[model samples]
Target: MLLLTIDSSAGASVALTRDGAPLDAWRTEQTTSHAEVLAPAVQRMMIGAGVTGADLDGVAVGVGPGPFTGLRVGLALAHALAEAWRKPLHGICSLDSLALRATDAGVEGEFLVATDARRREVYWAQYIRDEKGSRLVRGPFGASATDLPELPAVGAGLGLYPQELRPATMDEDPSAWVPDAAELGQLAEGALVGELHGVLCQARPLYLRESDAQVPVQMRQGGS
Candidate 1:
């Protein structure tokens, strides 16, 4: 099966795969550049891999526990591609993809996958690796550093998170911290087997908290 995976959940990523073998994968640091970079990357990946929209069997996108703007870039792109090509679209959680990347990097024991969510909070989840696979234990929630469960060999999207969230065993690789589109494709393959539901429409970006900027200011003096 040929699949295209896009992940703008943390860093922007685009990957092409055939029968689970990665044909091409591209990821770039785009702290706030998703709007400008995602599409071009998609087009470039297609060209680099010698594939076209029509050649893809499915599309896998990282639905996020991320900042609103970047998350939308990927989700919108995936939706547009799915609609245009009339192909099955799958959504994978951005945090799950990060955790998968961490595990693939040789992380053992429980893990606390985290991404910075500015304003002194982070998007985080706790997972435990088992015979089946890693399962979420803490949250897909945004929390202050104090709120996360004990970190475990933590990695993935660290700049989007707080320093205190790093575990004692942390194997920090800011580069590896971002989600892997190739891994996203692999997860999509697993989901296709009915191991997990692959609902494109129901796939919502998991923003754990509303933007801090959106919070209404309270009067210190008294009610306004």
Candidate 2:
């Protein structure tokens, strides 16, 4: 199946995939520019692949435990495109994509996947890969880096708190280790094939914490 995938959990990334294999991909590590860069990145990938929304079988997105602003940018676009194209929308955990990357890179046994959650914390999960595939074993929790267990960890969290989170040998350089749309697409494909039941979810934002934005006290009290 041909799929267009997007992720803004860390930075912004988009990809075109066919039967779980990447056809083309684009990314930018500028976190704050997801709103500006994500759509164009998708357009560039689709054009490069010589396909359009109509040619896609579905849309896959990283429904993230990321900051509210970045996650909304990607999820909103994915929702709009899916609705317009009348295609199924699949949501893969952004942390799962990171685990896939580590597994593909040959990290062994159980390990942790984490990404920067800002405010000196991280969004983290544990996984183990075997003959079947990578399986989430522990968390999708949000906590300070120092609070995370000392497992060999991969993802942007390593870059932020290398001293606290042990860096997996395969992912020593975590600077560029954000969730990839292509990897997210692969996981979605696995679910479509029934190999990953319960892994894919509805196309919705997975914000693990409450939004920083809040109504003022006067507004809540009906004072206008």
Candidate 3:
């Protein structure tokens, strides 16, 4: 299947995949420029791959437990492309991409996937990889690092609190890990083949908490 995938859970990333394999991908760790970078990056990836939106079977996106603004930028672009092309839209948990990367890197047994949630907390999930494949066993929870169950962990969360979370492997670099659009596309392909039922979700943001932006009480009371 031909797919266009996007992720802005940690940074802006875009990819084109054919039958679950990455054809091309692009990313930047600049978290604040998702809006400025995502759409243009998608266009470039598609052009470089010599394909167009109509050539894609579907659009896949990381529905994140991430920063609200970044997540919204990704989802909005994915929604626009899916609607414009009239292709199916699939939502893969951003954490799943990290777990997939860990498994690909030969991480065995069970491990934790955590990403920076800011405000002195993390977005975390647990996964186990057996012969069958990796499966999320618990959590996509948001919590303080001190509250997380001790485990070998991966993702940007570890970079922020290396003393609190163990690294999944000696070679693992905590700061370098973030969800990728290529990985999100692979998971979406698995879902299409019925190998990953219930893993794919509706095209919506998986928010862990209320957005920081809120109307002030006086404004709500029409007293402004």
Candidate 4:
């Protein structure tokens, strides 16, 4: 099967997998570039792999527990392509993708998979790594990373918070923080095989807190 996976929640990543092997992959840290670069990036991978929209068997997307704008851009593109091509659409949790990446990177024990959610908070999750896969142990929460309850941590971007609050054992480097597309391919496989849920409706963004737009005008006015 030919699968195209997209993740723009944390960083922009695009991957093309055939069967279970990644045929091609590309990523960019273009935070504001999703709208302009997504199509071209996907096209480059397709062209490199010598595949077309008609060749895609499915569209797998990282439906996010991420910031509103970046997450929506990737989701909208995935849905648009899926509908236009009449291909099946599958949604994968961005946090799950992070968990999968952590496991693939050899992180064991408990993990707090996280991505930078601006406003001094993070879109985060707590999971345990086992031979079977990662199991969510605590949260898919949005809160000040500093306020995060104590837990063993292994994730990217630890510097976002005070050193005292971060997981003491996890590496505190930016390089350690990016999500992997290869694991995304494996995640897509599980979803495709029905071992995981593939329904789009149920796969809604796990935004743990109320969005800025959702805040009432009074709250905005009063800084509540």
Best by TM-score: 3
> Could you give candidate 3's per-residue lDDT for residues 51-74 as a string of tens digits?
987799999999998999999999
Q: lDDT score, residue 15, model 1?
A: 87
How many clashing pairs per prediction, in order? Answer: 5, 0, 0, 1
Cα error, candidate 4, residue 199 (Å) = 10
Strongest candidate by lDDT? 3
> What TM-score does prediction 3 earn?
0.96
- Residues 1-224, candidate 1, lDDT per residue (tens digit)? 89999888777888888776789988887668988988898898888878888898999988887888888888899889988999988888777776677677666678787777767776777877777666667667777767776655354435444455554243456424666688888777767766644323245677676654554456554557
| Better-scoring candidate (TM-score), 3 or 4 | 3
lDDT-based ranking: 3, 2, 1, 4
**Candidates in order: C-alpha RMSD to true structure:** 4.6, 1.5, 1.3, 4.2
Local distance difference test, each candidate = 0.74, 0.87, 0.90, 0.72
Pick the winner on lDDT between candidates 2 and 4: 2
Considering TM-score, which of the candidate structures 2 and 4 is the better prediction for this target? 2
lDDT of 1: 0.74
What TM-score, over all chains together, does every model reach?
Answer: 0.83, 0.95, 0.96, 0.83
Off by over 4 Å in 3: none
Task: Encode model 4's per-residue lDDT on 105-126: one tens digit a residue.
Answer: 6678776776777887777778
lDDT of 2: 0.87
